[model samples]
Target: MLRDSVTAASADRAARGRAARKRVPRSAHGTWIPAADRPDPVGLLQAQGRDRLPELLPVRYARMAASPLAFLRGGAAVMAADLAAQPHTGLTVQLCGDAHLLNFGLYAAPERPLLFDLNDFDETFPGPFEWDVKRLAASVAVAARENGHKEEHVFGAARAAAGQYREAVRRLARQGELTVWYQHIDADLLLPLVRSGRRRRRTEATLTRARRRTSLQALGKLTETVGGRRRIIHDPPLLEPAGAMDTASLRKIFSDYRSTLPEERRLLLDRYRFVDAARKVVGVGSVGVRCFIVLLSGRDADDPLFLQIKQAGPSVLEEHLPSGPYVHPGRRVVAGQRLMQAAGDAFLGWTTGPEGRAFYWRQLHDMKASADVAGMSPGELRAYARLCGTALARAHARSGDRVAIAAYLGGADTFERAVGDFALRYTERNADDHAALGAAVVAGVVPAAPGV
Candidate 1:
């Protein structure tokens, strides 16, 4: 069976290569995934996340099964599986496979500039652009439903997301590379859009809050002194303080990781000297995985930089992607993240943990935050959608075929309509899944988390 799978994958790669060569505008291999024969979205997610589902908060689990639409929206791996089964236009890159309403956010670029890009790369891989769009649109539809919008209103939001994506991609193609790079979604452009009749006062308030979100705030929350000692304290079953790890065991792991780093980075990091590290649970999907936040203090007390070393599992995008020479999943994530984000963390790096687990390291809380969906108005939603769309397009353009994609999209109308259709259909699917989850919770099939 393994041999057969390998052979089939090899054949697919060859076919994709040929197809890419024949196209009017050249593109990466296997970039497009036709919508006709996608996978059963729900089943795909269940399969990929089976081992970790029990570890998720029951409230989150309930929300996943709250409705078919909700389930479909949350089950990105499932969608990727389905998309992988279809024919595609063959534009490929390291995609943020689970791009959704909440995934877009603000971050510090390398030059200390604040920029926006896809914040999550857990599912990053070379995949079809449409798959990302479909997922994002569906998320809008489900999120709208979560906000109490009716079906028609939900579809309207999805349509709006699609329209924005179509227009934004084309617009970037016409701009100079430097101009596109310098461009950012600031508060000024959005205030008028929201203040006008198109948005609500409440939504404007949310954007106002998002604009204020920064890494400094994260540092304040995540960094604290414990028991008269300045340190990041442990929040049990979640954020475990470093003092919890067995020193002998950690020293062994750190020694191994040191070998993996380049000589210069290793030397630079060595100056801080390892105080301690802890196993932490982080993010919705990443909980229960082995995540460690290493605290390294240099000469001064304020010179402390916390680095989160998170385990890298197989890409949620693995099934759809053509295998390459990447030996470490962590490396794949780090590389893809650097390519996709306009500016990345200066300390971005990767290493293996004890037991050979792939892990990516980054400064914890270097001003990371997200948009609050519940606080957004209809107008704010639309403006945020445009921001995410343009960012997604730019990320893809950097790694894939911008010229071909732009030519195929031509103008936003046709593609937008197609995406709108898929989004509406998928949103219905999410509602169904969400409802199923609720049923499961009621039946005690899955325990419910407190928040729901």
Candidate 2:
């Protein structure tokens, strides 16, 4: 019996070693990358992003790639794959998939406080937690470069980001239940926490700007005076003029989606009567896919609500993470989005449309806001990056094995160096992808109007 026990233990150890050995592929630095492969990280994402561009306005595409910085802003999908190939402690979590500098911002929580957490989770999934951190770090380095900061500052910010992630995870690992429950980052409390004078001014300015991004502002800009009435109009080949969706078809899709939601969510949605629905263009990377906004109004005209039904493609992180065969990619996206976001759109749902196209639906504008990284000064960038880092730690802590991660990170600078190295390399790769997209536009492969 003793010999048999010894043999079983030996076999288990051997199996674990073999699996680990198979998992760790070589990195860009020539070391074994235990998470995913090194090269071709951007292949699937680039293909998907390119296909989605025609849905964008001609002017929007030009504007999205107007500058290297702008181009970098639009290419989160491409950057994700590069970061996924690095060495990590194998701690999986529901990642934000595209947690760049621009993805963080203020939103109204159910409590009415200006709460901040990851806002976009379309590409989210259970994967190596470092992929999200690495993406955020690379964006900081690149955005810092765009703002004319020196390399040292960029590297410093990257290291600070990793340090915060490691420290936060370690702290969370040892925290009492109440301590973990009580933590939340309010934008109002941020100015005092940021030490840099330049950064403080930037944060103040950003806060002021975010306050200006109200529902009324969005309505004013997106809607127009049509036939002596204000309405959301579609501009052809650019903004799909509002009549794009057939009313019958929309109801059918929504009905199918309704069947997929939980009983409580389905009942909550009964309050919303879909008024007008139309397909619209949104972000640069997410262009070309079918995205529609459903206008919902209650008894009074003033009681208006909006919901966005977006098609969910295969995860950009799936190539890196373990996603057992999904019957519907939209379900995977909705699940990941729910896992990562502290508070999500109340009406979020998922359905597989015609031809097996996967899609997830949510509130179109539930008080969403984003950082204007283009306008931020260097100091502001650093402070904002730190905030992003801390928030990322919180998100990772929600679904990942924090204890094992903290143990692997154990007072060592591996988290810092590994991500910093990825940031530097991947930033260069971003520039290249941006250039390629620019060339494609120049070759007339894609269309965009001037001042876009």
Candidate 3:
């Protein structure tokens, strides 16, 4: 009976996909326009700032004003609004909701292999799969422009990425369900896939750096020995000690978080006791959100475990996209991440703060690193874009109807060409939005802590 039900559901989904293509033809995806009632981009950003740390909001604006690509990274909410206005097939998936190029990276799996997958899920939720693809393609185009690549190269990168995504989804759709669920692109497997010598070397270098970024390495870099006791060092606005009330609340929250973990993981966590914690600013888009690095110690001074407890607000897509079943924002992120990633952090869990804020916790630095796209040559950037697209396809296939999505994409280059054109157009829109933000900063309408 269960088997019949599952098969029936799959067939229904495939039918829906076919019907969606009829409703919104694949070629029509190239068109994009702001809605007549589209909200102001600056106004949307300011709305987000209301919930963030007041002091660090300037840093967020400055980061966004750095470049067009930088602006795109911080403008996920703005893009979500635009994407909501665009035509969609109504196929929902566990989107990395902010699926920019920089969000894909390398992290250590349980067996210690460096695996490449989506690393950030701050904006993750169930949304139209095409929104994620469009964001990725636009990011590629914007980043290419930032790197001074030719227009042809920019569009070529976007096209290649879209093609890779379409082809990958098709390939995964044909595989066994178990195989698709277990598939992961490890660094070793990824290196051979890079045809360019420069890209291969860059991949190797990134892997080397990722391997060295363990919890112990982070302990050395972020903490210090003061009067025979280990404590998180203060580094001005970027990293500083949490307030007494905040620390107390976090300790209580950690207790609640431990209950959500597996028994074995909880047991492993029992060996360590909370020692200290500090507020640490991180990432271009996450500067103002309350992020903390907590220190835990075992039996000896050398034994250490660092955990990051970050505030998880509503996903950027929550307002614009159809809502899911999640009530806790942190749980939404944790669930979406586990559903998308092949292997997730063993300690991934969520808790609610005393003030009703949702927060998620994970290892501070467990062998993680992102490729430096700015330094990549045009050829290398194109290759990297392809890998990101393939990774995104794999993630989407995990929770969405892969066969249906692949069928809508079809064997022709219609979807690829449309998305590529959309990417180029969106890049121009992003540049104008960025310039507006810069002018706002200059006019003193928006506070900015430039270069911080």
TM-score of each: 0.79, 0.82, 0.96
Error of 1 at 147 (Å): 2.0
Q: Estimate the lDDT of model 2.
A: 0.66
| Stretches of model 1 off by over 4 angstroms after superposition | 1-74, 150-152, 175-193, 196-220, 223-228, 242-271
C-alpha-based local distance difference test score of model 1: 0.64
Candidate number with greatest lDDT: 3
Which candidate order results from sorting by lDDT in descending order? 3, 2, 1
Error of 3 at 149 (Å): 1.1
Candidate 3 lDDT trough over 10 residues, lowest sum: 187-196
Between candidates 1 and 3, the lDDT winner: 3
Q: Compose the digit string of candidate 3's lDDT tens values, residues 284-378.
A: 88889999989998877677888999999999898887678799999998999899998999889999986799999998888998878895667
Q: What C-alpha lDDT do the candidate models reach, one value each?
A: 0.64, 0.66, 0.89
The superposed Cα distance between candidate 2 and the true structure at residue 151, in angstroms, equals 1.3
Ranking by TM-score: 3, 2, 1
Using TM-score as the yardstick, the better of models 1 and 2 is 2
What is the Cα-based lDDT of residue 106 in candidate 2?
Answer: 79
